[model samples]
Target: MFDMFKNNPISSIACVLPPALVNAFAKQNFYSPEQVRHVFTNELKTEHNIEYALAMFCSQLDFDALQLAVTYKELRANVAKECFGGWPRFNFDSLLDYSRQSAGAGGGFAGDGGCGDGACGGGGE
Candidate 1:
């Protein structure tokens, strides 16, 4: 999955987003697209946040925000299904907390020997 994401054209948007946000999404366990979308949209709601960052970056690169958003939505859905197995609802806040704790402990991201269940390595948690 990480390889697919890396090779995907839409994955370039990850460069515009904060590394922490990208890492959190990729490393953490999100049971459903709706759950991840809720957290993602909320994370972008702040001024000069994800949406603003994407818009500014995309504008300079002549990328389309609407199309990128659509593609990003698809990416999130795929991540939820492939990495999380579309399991039962999980707490988004808890996932964020776990991410923080893991990072603080020098665990890095999931693929880097973090506490995650190897989801980012292309297997479900």
Candidate 2:
């Protein structure tokens, strides 16, 4: 994915930003890189903190071939709850709710519910 943005510096940095940060900018209708940077800086409160939310956000790349990453660990808990037998002894009720809301807001369902194509069908099992 970085290779795809090698020629486009803005896109390269854009790809590096977490989806949450990207959503924050979009939600505020931020139109400039400086504005986005400002919000990120202030919300996080740091001069050059590598621990910015986006930095933590991009740590989990879903697929090696894709730039999209799933940084929401709650989503994983939800998956484990709904399909893999309810998260053992953990309290996933709220996690399930947030995951559902997030998935809904992001559009469509997840997991083996026969939503579409081969997706969420559990890998031909």
**Best prediction by lDDT:** 1
- Over 4 Å off, model 2: 1-31, 49-125
Worst 10 contiguous positions by lDDT, candidate 1:
8-17
Per-residue accuracy of model 1 over 23-118 as CA lDDT, tens digit each: 555543222333334444554343222332333222222334245544443434443333233422323443344344433552333322232332
Q: Candidate 2: lDDT over CA atoms?
A: 0.32
Output the number of the TM-score-best candidate.
1
Every model: Cα RMSD to truth:
11.7, 16.5
In the predicted model 1, the residue pairs found to clash are none
lDDT of 2 by residue, 14-101 (tens): 2233343445555322224344455545443443422222222222242222333442354444434443344423222322333344
Error of 1 at 91 (Å): 8.4
What TM-score goes with each of the models? 0.27, 0.20
Candidate 1's error at 116, in angstroms? 4.4
